[model samples]
Target chain A: MSPSPPQLSPKELSAYFAFTEVSSLLRHSVEKQLKDAGQLSYVQFQLLARLGDAPGGSQRMTDLADGVVYSRSGLTYQVQLLEQRGLVTRAPSPEDERSTIATITDDGRGVLATVFPGHIATVKDLLFDSLTADDIEGLERVLTQVSAHLRANPPRSAGSRKKS
Target chain B: MSPSPPQLSPKELSAYFAFTEVSSLLRHSVEKQLKDAGQLSYVQFQLLARLGDAPGGSQRMTDLADGVVYSRSGLTYQVQLLEQRGLVTRAPSPEDERSTIATITDDGRGVLATVFPGHIATVKDLLFDSLTADDIEGLERVLTQVSAHLRANPPRSAGSRKKS
Candidate 1:
């Protein structure tokens, strides 16, 4: 037989389900808005937003993948699509020729500007509206701890196989 | 020019970013565990879990999709794969001939049993370990509220276009 199940209490189980389900719904809701408002898939929008927030509007390809918790190959394809749309540009990194760097284009910023209002509104409507400020604080505090723990042993895209 | 950005306070913005980033990382970590342990993708695991938890270990395909916040077509393909693997079977609903019902097979439960230990451990490691009882309650309370709000409107698969 399989190994015995982990000893999680009912409350722990409920919180886990709640976290995953709510996050999925929140993502789906914003994905529709992003698609309708600017034709951006969630990953594409994340790519653009990350680049837009970066210094000089740029980051290494692998870093982009890690930042978004996406697969390296998937990030490459999304960046290529963004490049084709003139929303971002890809080039060999100055610090490392073997590594590619992606930078947001004027059009990318323009698209983000176009979508930011609706994106924020949707998040607020679906999430913040249901949350008190204390809830938000508790959320940020707990998730920040969880996030730090997860990030400490970073994904392969970020920490290991960087040269791949 | 684009409309102005929403007036989200810095704290609100930080909380939002923290929420999205941490959720993504948590998902990535658990997906790896699911893949390695049972060769199940996150969606596949969720589908089986939902079916396993349902009465008679079955649910309509559309309801399954919405319960997991997956696209209808995507859920169909996943179900087909599961069917091929002999982990699940699909049949016409007795009450509604037009709707397909997916039932978890014994093998599906076996696979879930195999993956259950690792899945629970991964969630606990990445999430529950860092959270206190109060944190768990707060997380559940806030997320349950958000989940209800999102579910009230429901997704296309669950509410609107049900006849489609």
Candidate 2:
């Protein structure tokens, strides 16, 4: 405030903001595209789409939460919303009823099938469009490192609960 | 809502979901860390931090909006909130009264100083902890391309109303 604080070196700040903007735009674009397939947020779409492919077409809710970026309760709420929409079914696991199992419904797969082309196109246009076949190779390489770093440290404990 | 349907190959889904999860988690980690820096959403922190070194300690609201990932209205709203907190001030430029120039205040710098160390530490922990210097360079490389792509195709129409 006084002498005017120095800016983050352009190099540091650029990477910081790059992750933010790229992800936000990607999320917005993907969500918009998914809506045309069904009234699904990206989270909802990911959840159903994941369950749609499990060996038995089902997974524990905890497994589902761990499988993606959403938290347990947040995912449960979305799964409830999806259940209401008839895209997925949630029922207690027979072996361990404390946790529910989520299964994708035929309707969910139908919607996913309906939306797949647009979803792929949107992802390609917004993300892959800007990358080369080599850039994709580079992205995959760096993303693996990043994904491992994040998984190893896992931020839910240390991250924001801003509304509070 | 009948039976299970055939699905995309697991390898394909793995690559697809990996990209989404890693990107979202990294951004969330960075933003969450900023909360401790005094309610700075990652975007807000980036805006204020960037403006700290803007030429003449001021920048056009539209330029500021483009500098960060936020929508023009989103930028305006957050700048107003920061102003209310006595962190920044806006002056209508004589050159373009339609565009306001925002300057950081001493009080704002104090807040940033207090918060930045921990934020950087978190970035290091969540992002760079496991990586070699080379990995960092690779991430920088890939993200630069992604950033360039996003900036080239910003979502809004150029002739849209000024957010401020």
Instruction: Enumerate the candidates' DockQ scores in order.
Output: 0.55, 0.28
lDDT string for model 1 (A1-164, tens) is 44556677887877777778779888888888899789999999999999999999999998887678766888888988999999999889888899998999999999998888988987877777777888888777877777777777565443355384
**Model 1: pairs clashing at backbone N, Cα or C within 3 Å:** none
Deviation (Å) of B146 in candidate 1: 1.2
DockQ, candidate 1, vs. native dimer:
0.55
Q: Best candidate, DockQ-wise? A: 1
- lDDT by residue (tens digit), candidate 2, A29-66: 77776785577788887887788889878999989988
Candidate 1 segments whose C-alpha is farther than 4 A from its true place: A1-4, A155-164, B1-5, B155-164
| Per-model lDDT | 0.83, 0.73
TM-scores of all predicted structures = 0.87, 0.82
Residues B96-132 of candidate 1 have per-residue lDDT tens digits of 8999999999999999988998888778777787678
Candidate 1 CAPRI assessment class: medium
